[model samples]
Target: MNLRVEQRALAQSDQDDVVVLGPNPADTTFETTSTEGAYKILGVRPGLTISVFDMVIGADFAGRFATEPCVAIDFLFEAAGQGWLLDADGERLSSLPYRPGRIYIMAAPKGAVGFYDVPVGTRFKGMDIRVDTTLWQKLGAGDILSSLDEHHSLHIASGNGTWVGVLPVPPQLLAVARALFDSAMVENDDLAFEARALDIVHASINAMRSIQPAATIPPRDRRPLQRARDLMIAELSYPWALDGLAREIGLTQKRLQTGFKAMYGYSVYAFLQEQRLLEARRSIESGEVTVTQAAMNVGYGNPSHFSQLFLRRFGVQPSRLRPSETGKYQEAQAR
Candidate 1:
C-alpha cells in the first residue's frame, strides 16, 4: 500500500457522498453525485488513477474540481450533461455539452474546473484516466499540454477554431477504450488496465501531433517558480504575498506570476488555494481534527466559508470524512 494512502486515510466514511481521497488529485473524476450516483476511483497503478462513474443524482449538482498537475483522458460512454473548460484566470475557454459515446482528454494544468447541471433521471457512464504530468510528459506529451484544456475538455475538428484540440476516437480505438471497462471490472488485473491506458494515450497523442498548438507562454525561470510553489505548500498557513514570495524565490513579481501559470497552469495564489484545500481534505479524513480545525490548519479562518469551499472542491461536505458521520452518510446512500 502507498504510505501516503495509509497516512491520509481519505475514504473513511463508507459514504455515498464522499469520494476516496487517494494520492492522485486528478482522481478528481468527471462529475460526482451528491446522493443520486456512485463512482469508484482507483489508483490501479503508479501515477495513474482510474475513475468509472455511473451517475443519476437526486438533486442539481455543480462541482468545483481542481487537481495537481496531471493529464486526464475521458471516455464518456453516455452523457447528457454540460460544463466549461476554464483557464488560469477561471475564464471559460470552452462551454458545450459533453459529447456522448466519445473519448476526450485534457491536461489539467491548474485544473480548477466545474461540472454540473446534470438533470435528474439522466444517466452518465464514463471512465476518467488521470496520469501524472511527469509520466505523460515523459511519454512526450508535454508539447501537447497547452492544447489540452487548462481545466476543461477541448474538442477537435469541431469547425470552431479552439475546439480543434481533441482527438476523435474511431471504431478501433473505441473498441480498445471499451476493453478497458472490462479490465476495470475484473479482479486483481492491474497490469491489463495499465497497458490499455498507455495504448489509449499513445493513440491520442499521435492523432493530436498534427494539429496546430494553442498559444504558448514560456516559463521565464522554471526552477525559481517551482521553488516559490514549494514554499507556499510548505507554509500554506502563512499568508502569502506575491512580491515577498517572488523575492524569497529570487524572481520578480511579474515573472513569478507569468512563469507560475506557464509552468503550473494556474496563478500563484490559485495554486496555493488548491494545495491548501487538498491538505485540508487529507487532514479532515484523518479524523484527527474538526472541519474547522482542518480548515484553520490549512489557513482558512472561517469554518462556514471553509465548508462551502470544501463542498465545491471535493463534492462532499468535509464532515462526511469523519467516522462518526458514516451512519448519516450511509443513510443518505440508502435513500
Candidate 2:
C-alpha cells in the first residue's frame, strides 16, 4: 500500500483540533478525533481517497483551514450548519448549506480555501470521495473527465478556476455509500476497504456519465421545466398525469416530455418517482414516519408494492433504514 499520513494543526489556538490522521499527500488510511468530533480517511490506492467527517464548530475558523485543488464527490447524509468556499482573492466561490441526502460534485483549484461557521451546538456529517485526474485517466474515463472539464472549466490548473455541480443523491449511489459505511464498521482488511472505495469512485464516475450530453436550457424552455419540477417537489403525493402536468405548464404532453428529458435526462414521471422514493427513504431513516406511512406520504397507497419498489431501488427494505435497524440488511447479506 502506498499510504502516507501527516498531521498538522489548523491554527495556533489550543482549542483548534489537529488532524489526527495526518494530511496525506498520497494513499493513506487514518482517523482523527478532537473535542468537537472525529474523521476517518482511507486512501489505499492510487488516485482515490474516501473520507468521513463528523464535526461541530463553535466559532469561525476561516483563516485556520486550507486544502489542495482536487475533484470531490460528496454525500451529505447529515448536516445542521453552513459552509463556504473562497477563492485565492477571498471571493466566495460557493455557499454550501448542509442539507441531508444532498449529493454534489465540486472541483477547487489548488489555492482555494474552505471554511465552516456553525452555531456552538450544530453538528455536521458527510462522506467525501476524492478522485484525481490521474485516476480518471487510468480508468479510461476521458469522456467523464472531459464532461466536467467542459461544463465547469475543471481543466484549469490550480489558481485558475473552480467548479461545482449539484444533483440528487441517487438510490444506487446511496447503496454504495451504505455499503462503504458498513464495511468501515466490520471489515478490518485494508484490501477490502480499498476495493469498496474504488467501487464508489467507479459508481460516481458512472453516475455522472448516466446524465449524459449535458446542455444548457434556453430561458424560454427552462421556465416551464423549472415550474414542472417545482410542482412535483412541492406536491410529491399529488396524483399527476402527463396531460395534466403539460397543461398546467402550458405545454403539450409531447413537448413537456421532450423538454423534461432534455433538461434533466429523465422522463417527467421517472424524475418524480425518484424524488418520491428518495423522500420516503429519508423520512423512514429520520424516524419521522413508519414504513407504511412513508409510502403513503410519497403517493404509494399499496404498502406491499411500495416495499418492493423500495427494495429494488435501495436494495433494502424501508424498515432497514431506521436508526435501530441500520445495517441489518447488509449483515444479513454478509451471512
Per-candidate Cα lDDT values, in order, are 0.59, 0.63
TM-score (C-alpha, index-matched) for candidate 1: 0.48
TM-score of 2: 0.67
| Off by more than 4 A, model 1 | 1-34, 86-93, 146-164, 212-335
Clash pairs detected, candidate 2: 3-27, 6-22, 6-23, 7-22
Model 1 over residues 1-335: C-alpha lDDT tens digits?
11011111113223334232222322433233243444556654455567766656445455555555666678876676676655556655555456454566655554345434566566676787777766777788778755543222233222112232344445457657767865665444656776776788788778666544324434336546646865775577998998889889888898888867765556888878877876676555446688888889889899899889878876778877663555234324544
Cα RMSD, each candidate = 18.7, 8.0
Error of 1 at 301 (Å): 64
TM-score of each: 0.48, 0.67
Q: In model 2, where do residues sit more than 4 Å from their true spots?
A: 1-35, 56-65, 109-111, 115-120, 149-160, 167-170, 185-187, 219-257, 282-289, 296-327, 330-335
The ten-residue window of minimal lDDT in model 2 covers: 26-35
**Candidate 1 lDDT for residue 323:** 39
